[model samples]
Target: MSFRLNPFKVMRAVGIVAIVVYGVVLVTGYKKSKVTTTESVTKDMKIRNKDFYKSKDYKNNLTLPNQVVENNNEAVAKELEQTKPAETVDLQKDSDTSKQQTDSKVADKNKKKEEQVKLEMQKQAQQKLAEQKQQEKSKIAAKQAELKKQQQLEAARKEQAAAQARAEAARQQAREEENKKAREEAAKRARENAKKHQGSKKYIQVASVTTEASARGIAKKLGGNFYYKKTTVNGKTAYVVMSNMTDNPNTLKAMENQAKRAGSGYMIRSVGK
Candidate 1:
């Protein structure tokens, strides 16, 4: 198919261009009309010289350019003054909206700061509690250690006391044994001294020694043996003595008579008779 441009679209574009050119021409070159130039002296535009002479009026045509310019300036100043207040009102409304937004942001920030401070305080309180607990635990541990040390010291003291008592008891036992030995030795020595004078004999009447010198002297004394010897009767000593002989009445009488006449002590002994 062949390309075709629509007539209505070309016409519409040409009309929009004509309207734009017309607006440019009107804005760039615009001047006041004759009516506006003459209206500067009167409130409305005056008629020309023909109408003035026909009406028999002396025209107020000596109008000043300064007055016209001044009036126009006053109108422009008033319009500008009126428009400025409206713009300022709109600006004040916009500034109020912006200030409200800024205040809202500040309030939100302060609220967040308060919340953060509360959280920080909570954390600090938790830390303080933890520290207190730790200190308590340390105190408890120290007290337990002190108690254990005291217990150990007490046990050591008791052990030392018991050991000393045991040593004292052993020393006392040793002293008792020494006293017993001494007593036994003294008794043995006394027995030996009492028997020292005895003679050797078998079957003595007693263990003590008899009188010295003769049989006449022997009848007046107790009889015994000195240095006696026998294996069975005693372990290493024996005893011998004199006694009466019996059953020879005539011979015994003669001997008794002889002893009585002499006043000599005679001992009676056993013989083979």
Candidate 2:
């Protein structure tokens, strides 16, 4: 049997191998970078040490002459002192310059602190001003609100007063109209009384009862004075119950209503001699 390659399987295997190779390359590169970083650090340390030593050696070389001259016998001391005084002066000048620079830096720091304090004060002042303005605004708003409330109250009071005045005027006018009507009614009553005196006034005969007691009882129940007259009715003597009222229509009508409450039969008639 011959072994046949599946193209898909072959491609899958190739891809897996390629992936493995890429991962290995990435790992190797990372390790190499770590190693290179370490070597570079070591080289930098060595170079720094070498440079430090060289600087120290240079300083020592420069100081050798001074050391030698100081170590020499007293015969050269005076000569060295005269020769090195200028250099000592220069060193002193350099120290003085350094001290001045330090003092200048301290003064600059103090000036900066003062400026910060001034700025803070300005901010505080601004904040205070803002608060004052806000207070003023609040006061103004309160005053305005109070003024508006007062105005509204005044307006309401005025409206109420006007309404009351109008109601009073209406009541006065109604009273005047009622007075006029009463006066006219009094005059009319006077005229009617005059007319009644000229002739016999009308009266209502409420009932005809055989007994005076019955007549009196009905008149008492009817709440009015009554009189009786003997009349012949059906050839028999009968006592008629009559109300004492005038011919005025209102009086007759009132008596008629009262007689209805007393009994059913009633008649209107004029007074006789």
Candidate 3:
């Protein structure tokens, strides 16, 4: 094959194709960028998947609601129990001892039942005794009340008797006062009758003459109606008084003695009327 070279036309065709492709690519990219708006966004603006959020959440899903923690002593005890030897129970060796224990338990229950019965009986006896005591007290109170009523009735009777005696004494005293008043009225009437007696009377009196004033004093010592008459023995006035005078000289002497005893100290004289 002989070479006949034509390079210009091939090169021009390649440049034109390249320019068209570049324009198409630029347009497509600009439209894509305008619709998406995510090329300049960061992780804070990015919408994350719900699956990724679930993986990153810190909440516990497997923990118990009321879990308990064993302390030091409890933990030790649990460890010892888990490591300790287990005891095996005997099936046939302790039969006689079990029977004896059962018998003793039955005996204790029976004894307690008997003691309860005895205590109940004692309580009943005490209650019966208390009831008897209350009855006896009621009887005694009844007797005391009856005795008091009797004593009150006796005292009332005695008071009635004493009041009657006092009334009788008052009646007797009023009767005695009535008799004494009647006797006094009778004696006053007799004395009035004696004072009104009138009959012809004689009088004799005696007097001393040492001083005229003394003889006139004796005459004036009598205190009844005085009669006056004038007679001149030596032209002097003589005054006299008349009273009840006795008719005998012996009675006149007695009257003179009585006048001498008087505190006026003038003796009686003879002035006949």
Candidate 4:
């Protein structure tokens, strides 16, 4: 099969290659520029040294004093005297210019150093201020957290106390209701007893018989506070077995129930005290 190239893939590959080539060109150009600058500085230094060696000042220094005397001593002496002051003045001017340039450079350096020191101090002060602010923020955050925790604890305590109070109130209400019910039951019982013992005397008649001996025997068999009594029933004399009298209807009811369990008949009777 013939190889087929995708246009998009070809474009992507071309773009990548172009980028790599551009980066390489940029790096090469920077290196070349650095090398050219170094070469130019060296060439300039060589030219200056060559020119200095060729200058009149260098040639004059090389000439011997015997050669100046041989040429014309008096004329050379006069010319030297004439040029001496001018040379001295030129040297002074050069020295002063050099001093001024040095002083100017020193002042610039001092100014730059002062500016640097001021900037450093400002940076330190700003950093200290920032740190102080950060510390204060941390303290405030910690205080807020502690306050929130305390508030939550207080709320929890209050809620617990309220719950306990509610429970106690409910228990108190329950106790009050129980006491009220007990008192009402006792009053109802008292009322029933009052109704039952309306007359001067009330007794439970357990049994009636013709003879006292029979009545006494039944009272003994019945047990529990039973006695015998003589009574007229149907206009005839009869002996009756009796339970003890009580003003409490509850007690009378208990006696009746007991008698019933023993399979005996009973009647309530009022008699003279």
Candidate with the greatest lDDT versus the true structure: 4
Q: What value of lDDT does candidate 2 attain over all alpha carbons?
A: 0.68
lDDT of 4 at 50: 52
Rank ordering of all candidates by TM-score, starting from the highest: 1, 2, 4, 3
RMSD of each: 27.2, 24.6, 43.1, 19.3
**Alpha-carbon runs more than 4 Å astray in model 1:** 1-86, 89-95, 191-273
Candidate 3 ranges with C-alpha deviation above 4 Å = 1-124, 192-253, 260-273
Record all residue pairs in model 4 with backbone atoms less than 3 Å apart, i.e. clashing. Answer: none
What's the TM-score of each model vs. the native?
A: 0.39, 0.37, 0.33, 0.35
Clashing pairs in 2: none
Query: What is the lDDT, from 0 to 100, of the residue 124 in candidate 4?
Result: 74
TM-score of 3: 0.33
lDDT of 3: 0.54
Candidate models: Cα lDDT each: 0.51, 0.68, 0.54, 0.71
Give me the displacement of residue 265 in model 4, in angstroms: 43
lDDT of 4 by residue, 1-273 (tens): 223345456456655655565555555555665666566555433234657878885688568587665667677566656652311124344445555655565557556655766676677777788989999999999999999999999999999999999999999999999999999999999988887767554567777899988888888777876789899988999998888877667877787677777663555454434
36-115 in candidate 1: lDDT tens per residue? Answer: 33444343322466556444223332343668767866886776666522111243444455556555655575566557
- What is the Å distance of residue 162 in model 1 from its true position? 1.4
